[model samples]
Target: MRRRGLAFIIVALMLGMLLAALDQTIVSTALPTIVSDLGGLEELSWVVTGYLLASTVSTPLWGKLGDQFGRKYLFVTAIVIFLVGSALCGLSSSMGQLIAYRSLQGLGGGGLMVLAQAIVGDVVSARERGKYQGWFGGVFAVASVVGPLLGGLFVDHLSWHWVFYINLPLGAVALFVIVAGLPNDKSQTRHRIDFAGVVLLGGATSCLVLLTTWGGTTYPWSDPVILGLAGAAVVLLVAWAVAERRAREPVLPLELFRLRAFTMSSAVGFVVGFAMFGALTYLPLYLQAVHGVTPTLSGLHLLPMMAGMLTMSIISGQIISRTGKYRYLPITGTAFATVGLLMLSMLTEHSSLWTMSVDLLVLGMGLGMTMQVLVIIVQNAVDFKDLGVATSGVTFFRSIGGAFGVATLGSVFSSRLNDDLSRVLARTRLPPGFDPAQVQQDPTAIQRLPPELAADFLHVYADAIATVFKVAAPIMLVAFALTWLIPQQQLRETTKAADLGEGLGATSAERSSLAEVERGLVRLADADLRRGFYARLGSLAGLDGIAPQGVWIIARLDGKGWVEAAELACRADVSRATGRPYVDQLVERGLVERSDDEDRLRLTGEGRVAAGRLTRSSLESLRGLVADWGDSPQLKRLCERITPELLGARADRPR
Candidate 1:
């Protein structure tokens, strides 16, 4: 494909990915206003939890279906569902309606995220995959930073519904680009849909999440509803296991748990999601209700944490990509997260925003370190056949953990606030018509009370939030310990730390083994391509005087054996006059020879020898990058497969 056309396709994919990632965080700052407008504070966590649960459960299904049926149409279908869901969410009149719509949106969001990333592997060459993957990470970082602030802007200026409505225009643009720029898919794989496993797993997960969300706050722990949910969760879990064992393709293969690395990473990822999303869900409430910050200002105050996460995630990914050492990251990351949670638990109404910002930054740093590292650890440990499932499995656990975390932590916050409110109200008198229950359901009701009464209510709110973090701190400690249990496996060249973007975005795209390795090598080989990297490869190939452009011409000749001089110029997007100099340079260096008509060029024996040398040099560079994989025949074949692309034409340079 032409470079401009390919770029458009990538842009479309990134837009799709951005829409899904943005939704995850955008609703956090809006939740306070949403609760105020919708009048169902008890169901507040469900807003985020519903989306998380639906997206999590649907991810693997989307992945498998895209594999069975080509991705092009499926990608379009996902965008349509997401946009429809977004429109419905904007029109919702109640919290219940909104939650339901958000789940529908999540179902589409899961497909958008997975298919978008997977399409990159399909459309882009292996050598450029790493570079594009890095761009995807940037998209996530932008979403994480901007989502909350954008949500707040919409809510404070317009109605809270605008938060969902905002996706409409973005989704339309992405849909247009994807349909116009993407080619029809030609590949398909046959596989069972695992309907039984998906149904049982979804049933069990919904039951478990509801149990956590409702057990104490909505109903007493001993209530029949709560007990029934518990019993149902257990029975469904057993049935799901049985179904998975018998299914031809389980939604989550049970055998993955046997790999200690997969098990440990999944566990740690779960806790990380628990603490991260739980805090994201509540911190805005604390800022808005207790500190009296506007929703927009509340989003601004959360920047410290987002900054820490983006910075540390990029830094850790770079370190691992370069040095291939990551065992320490998760352990230290969990330690920081635990400390950060404890710090957050210490906040009271009197705590300054600066203090809170510092605490959030610490927690964000911890989360950043562990989130992507766990993905890498699992990818490295799994066998080739399990690579896709294993990677998605880790992500699944983290997402489910977030769902449970928000629900469970919200329950704790609600229970603690109820108890505190009862104790304080029993000893004090309230203004006429001011019901204590009103304050529990609507935090904004505190502002309507007298100054002294509002102070007491704010203190109760602060205590409840602090207790939420307190409950999460120990869970993070368990993740810290699990990091120790993750065996230290050598990082493969096929999987680079730079893929932290996919991990950060929490996508569930499953790549084949060859695709995975190609992505890592392309990232390493092309890391410095813009800064004369081709020239460096030329020098490595013993072509000392060749410019990067000359290197391009030689590689073109090497790949095609011969090329019409005018055709080469046209492919390079340059005039024949401008491109002739590079071809002349290769000819002068005896790496190419003119055809009898002098209108075409082909590599000479010397040129072929230089091309062979370049191939070996490129392979050696990749081999060194994955030295831990050893010099086996399998490694050689993989390197051979990758070298041509690495030393092939540079799309950005003159041929």
Candidate 2:
């Protein structure tokens, strides 16, 4: 059956991914312009880096909240938060303010991306998920190309700040669509907070991001800062694992990672992020530095990569849907990306732009095929009960990878840029007062440098770009190896209740006595017991009362045209030592069945008929006895004179 909820999820997710992915590249083209105007080029990377750091940490929190409070609400909340942050970003007056605001944006952005995908898994069945995943991939891939273009357009034709400002209205619309129409369902909530798990998870993630951000940028790998962050990460991560084992509800379910597919997919995320970002981040620089292309043109040049990604994602989704095959998609994607990355590793200052586009296309195609496919598979294999946690865990890993890639690979790029610049500057005829390091970090300085020095600096930037890609290429190979860990077991498509294996498999209809009384076909006043209601009824006519309450228990025992006296007596424990004779009297009046069993006290066809009538009467009597006082005339009159009257107050009654 088609899932009723998929459409709601798909619409919400498309918007979320559009916004999240757009943020990743939208500012790329505008970065140079923003820095030039703001005069804080030394901290240019923070605008991106701070967001990445904050967003990565926040992704898991959103996932956990989605599982706790309902994804629909959390998703809407994220959009609101993001739009607010975007508006703030547009209003920022300095580089530091922009970085702080971007960090806020990342908090919402991370939640938007992770929660949307998790919501998709919750609403759709796994086997059917690839198609939607393909759609999500298409959204992401389109954003990759369109973001830079949009950023460039805003910078060239409009103010650079419009890049952030445009998000406000789009976000408002997305939020409205989600909050106004989506069903409010907190079905996944556990009713208790996972305090320990959230604490451990947050600590673990914050430390890990710190390790990634600080290791290459702030200090050496062995320095106190790096080592301390690493140590804290390990301790918190270990504590998180232990806590999850004992937690009534966990934010980070460590058990999920034990799945081979999950492990492989997580590794794939890291590798893909490492290679993908390292390459994409520098492409704009390469265009401006080496090819002398405008930012708008650089954004336009990236369309091939986005095209490749979108096409592969959609195609893989269709293929998987048709064949029920997902195992091969990731392997193929990783392999393709690896080859493409290796090819790009050979780039030089004069490498053909068309050739670079082809390589990027190959890389994007590889990426599109795998990223969503892995998530879809992992989602499918997990029990439906853990849908939120399972989906969120994978997303969390992907974010972690993206964060690490940007920071770690960025450091590689920066270090290489520095070393290459030193070499290029060594043979220079520059005066003693000008240091290449000082100029390279400052956008205004780079723009005003002597022509030869600028050319050499640009060359250094190009070489650093190539070096990052070369290092990232090996990471792609690692991603390919990780794909092997996923078990090839076919995705077990399921419907509700399929989780109960065949050991006790039975639907409600299959194990019932299809009879008149049971089906509500028998009536006490009908004077006709269908032959079926009587069949075998005498054999088990021992029903009697054993309840602590004097009231008898009754149910339509069979679809046989009538009820059984002896069966009602035994089931409800109407004992021979007790009111057996009164029951017999009712049977004698043709109100119940009486039989020869138990000294002619057992239920017969006649007795069974009477039993249903009397039990039904007694049940109604019990119901009426307790419904005594509401709207009763006696009760109403006694309280009325003393009660305050509505709009009938007397002057003497004023208190």
Candidate 3:
């Protein structure tokens, strides 16, 4: 494809991503106004909870459907659903109507985020994807900062309804650009949709989300409704697991959990999502209720955190791209997050805005280091065939985590606030018509209260919020521990051909040529040149017995961190039958060992040492090759311009 066309498609996809991302926070600042207008203050939580429930349940389904039916048309369909739902939300006459419409919007919104990442994976090489994915992190940061401000502006000037209405023009523009720019290609392979699996998984997710949202809030933890939902969730989850094992095409493959990186990364993602979302959701409440800031001012105050996140995300991407090592980044990030949360727990009603800003910045930097890299890690770990499912799987866990975190922490906050308020109010003579419920529901209402009463309310809220943060700080420490368990895998230089196969409209002959060119490039960039350098270094390092094929296998194992024998065979372009002899050879030579389950292969300690030496040798060789070209801007420019052209020319060739 032409550069202009690819650029347009990317912009369109980002806009689509922005639409969903913005909606997650846009209504938050507008919620009080929405409740005032719609007269359903009691049901206010449903407005947010409904969207989260629908989106979480639908995320994996959209990915599976896109993989089966092809992404272009399905993605466009999602945008249309979102637009229609947005329009309906704007026109809603009641809070119940808005909540129902938001669920419909979530049905579409779920697709936007996962599909955007999958599409980028399809088009860009993993080597270059880090930089591109950094842009996504930036978009998310900007949306977080902008969404509340936009919601506040709309509520204060136009109406709370305009928050929903604003999506119309943006959605239309995204729809048009995507339809015009993205290629529509259906898969030739017949896929059986896992109908039973979908139903079971959806039910399980909905039940779990409901359990969290309602537990200790709408109902007691021991209430029959809450207990029933919890029981149903467990049953549905187990049934879904059984269904996946039997289904020909599972929506969420059971086998992915066998991979250590995928499992650990998913767990880490969930915890991070829980901590970040839980903190972000309530931080504004703290600022407005305790510090007496307006919605717009609270939004503006969040800028330092957003800036910290954006700066670190871009820097982390560059570091990962240049160094090809990402395991320690998340570990460091989690450390920062733990410290930040601990500091936040110490905040008092008298704490200055500058102190709060510094705390948030630390938290943002920690999040920046982990969030995007987790996606990249999982993408690099899985096979191309499972890419869509793997991407959506991580997203699914994160979304569920956010829902669970918010409910759990919100419950804690509510309970503490009520207890503290009651105790404080018992000691003082109350002002007439000063309803605690009204003041709690609307932070702005405190401004109209007697000054002495308002100060007490503020102090109560501040102490309660601080206790919530103290409880949350321990969660970040758990995330930090999980980060250490993720083994580092080298990022692949090329995108998997299987992922890009049908989407870009290349003919058979062009595909073959493209494949040949890509293989040649890989050999030049990864294997042949590196092996030659390693050979020379191996002799000096007393590792002279390794063959080129053995080295190739070692490289593959190192790149994947650990892979099942069948998957490793597929990656190395050999059938399982043909690959067995090679694996036997490696095992006999003591260079590879089977994991405890005896289903996967990983390098032995000796093998790891050998691999590290080879990697270092290769880097040294590349540096030597480029040594003479130092300080020459033209050489760098030429390499950049020519590399993509060499790759793109084969795609443009005629059949």
Tell me the deviation in Å of residue 228 in model 3.
0.8
Give the residue spans of candidate 1 off by over 4 A: 528-551, 559-562, 570-582, 588-591, 595-599, 604-641, 651-655
Better of 1 and 2 by lDDT: 1
Q: Roughly what TM-score does model 2 have, to 2 decimal places? A: 0.66
Residue 510's lDDT in candidate 1 = 59
lDDT of 2 by residue, 1-655 (tens): 2334446546766786678768877887777667656755435556776676677656556755676778787888889889888999999889989989998998888778767655665565332344454465456656765877888788778897899998887777778767766666647744455678867776776687567656665688899888988888999988888888887767656777777777677678766755665566667766765666666887888778777876776677667656767888899999999988888877877788999989889988898777667666665566544554655566556655666676667677667776777787778888678866565654435556777667777667667778878888888888888887777665432111111101000000010111101111111211112222222222233333322111121223212444454544454444545646555454555434445454433344644553455344333322232222233343233222212111011111111
Preferred candidate (lDDT higher): 1 or 3: 1
* Model 3, residue 492: C-alpha shift (Å): 4.3
Sorted by lDDT (best first), the order is 1, 3, 2
Task: Judge candidate 1 against the unseen true structure and give its global Cα lDDT, from 0 to 1.
Answer: 0.85
lDDT of 2: 0.61
TM agreement with the true structure for every prediction: 0.92, 0.66, 0.71
Relative to the unseen true structure, what is the C-alpha lDDT of residue 528 in candidate 1, on a scale of 0 to 100?
50
Candidate 3 regions exceeding 4 Å error are 1-11, 32-46, 70-73, 92-95, 114-138, 176-189, 380-388, 489-655
Ranking by TM-score: 1, 3, 2
Query: lDDT scores for all predictions?
Result: 0.85, 0.61, 0.69
Residue lDDT tens for model 1, 1-655: 7789998899999999999999999999999888877888878999999889888888878888888999999999999999999999999999999999999999999899889988987898776777888888788899988888888898889978999998999899999998988998788878888888888898999999999988878888999999999999999999999999999877788989999999999999999889888988999999988988888999998888888888898899888988989899999999999999999999999999999999999999999998988989998998766776787788888888899999999899889988898899998887787677777777877777788889999999999999999999999998898899988877776666457566677556655554565567677677655567677888898889888787777776785666798887776778888877777888888889999887888999998888888778777777787565455565568778877875645554632
The sequence of per-residue lDDT tens digits that candidate 3 reaches over residues 1-655 is 5667878878888888888888887777777567656765445556766676677777656766776788888888889989999999999999889989999998888788767756765565533444455565456666766877787778777888899998999989889988887777544335687889878987887787677666786788999999999999999999999999999877779999998889988887777777766776677777777777766677677767666666677677668767778899889988998898899999988999999999999988997787767766776687655655676576666666666666667677777777887898789788786667776666556667788878888788789889878988898899899999998875654322112111110001111112222332332343333235334555644566755455556656763466887876655566777666666777888889988876799899888876666565544443343333243444334344333322212121111
- Candidate 3 TM-score, C-alpha based: 0.71
